[model samples]
Target: MNAHDARGSTQLLTRLFDATPSDAELQEALKAAREEYRVLRWWKLGQPAVDAIKVKLDIPQERAGSVLTELVQLHSDKLQVTVNAFPYGLPALDGVLVDVTMERQVTG
Candidate 1:
């Protein structure tokens, strides 16, 4: 199906930030607390979502995620970003199988 037909689909872009310390020694690096990563979603009205991340992280106004073309330009050493697109509809389900788990696990 076309983009317009993918009603429930969205493009997700995630940014990861890690401490400068080595992973093996991370636990001992008490001063190097890891920061939380941020994710951005793209859609017809997705600018506001991007803006929210910018505001929450105090990102510069110039680093807005309004357009995909500009997304890379806004990148910095502060974080690493990965983009993924999921467009689901008749086209995506042409031969896909659906499975459900009926078993529930018990915990103490």
Candidate 2:
């Protein structure tokens, strides 16, 4: 398998071997993680526009949009710092190694 595939498999295995949490424990963990990273926006190149990040914030749909927009605008700097740190976000995955090989050739 390629390095990318291997890394994905490793992560799957790691999660599988990890102990499962109770529903209450899971909810608490999710709440903490979400609070730390308020928004997670991902996109592929050439997409028409950014996809929406959805959350059931327990507010009316009408007000949720305005609230999220205001929060993002108010904390744009902090949000950006969180986004920038996404690449190195998971410390447990630090042991995962990747080796890529390149072939140099001349094409006419």
Candidate 3:
């Protein structure tokens, strides 16, 4: 995938890739992408079926887990992290991994 496709800020990065982008320019686009991610926002469903990051945020399913991890770690102040447990009740998949999600931190 092209840089823009991966970043999801296609318009901003499209021009950057056409020519060599300066350090400042690249940093600027990165900042813009981060802000967009925050602005778009994400939420959780009552059931463990589908999630906002995968369906609403339009993030690829393969990357959802890692993306959630980075978002909470880097922007903890702006986000509220939660872990929901729904036991698989099976031997093979029970010990695989945990489920984690994030939502915006509400303000008064």
**True-structure RMSD, every candidate:** 20.6, 17.5, 13.0
lDDT of 2 at 18: 38
Query: Each model's TM-score, in the order given?
Result: 0.19, 0.25, 0.26
Candidate number achieving the greatest lDDT relative to the actual structure: 3
lDDT of 1 by residue, 1-108 (tens): 443332222211221222233555546543332222122322222342321132112122232233233344444554333332232246333221111111112234
lDDT for each candidate structure: 0.28, 0.32, 0.43
What order do you get sorting by TM-score, best first?
3, 2, 1
What TM-score does candidate 1 reach?
A: 0.19
Better of 2 and 3 by lDDT: 3
- Residues 1-108 of candidate 3 have per-residue lDDT tens digits of 654444333322332244456779879977965654323344444343222232224333344456556545633544455653233335433221234454444578
lDDT of 1 at 49: 32
Poorest 10 consecutive residues by lDDT, candidate 1: 96-105
* lDDT, residue 51, candidate 3: 20
The lDDT of model 1 is: 0.28
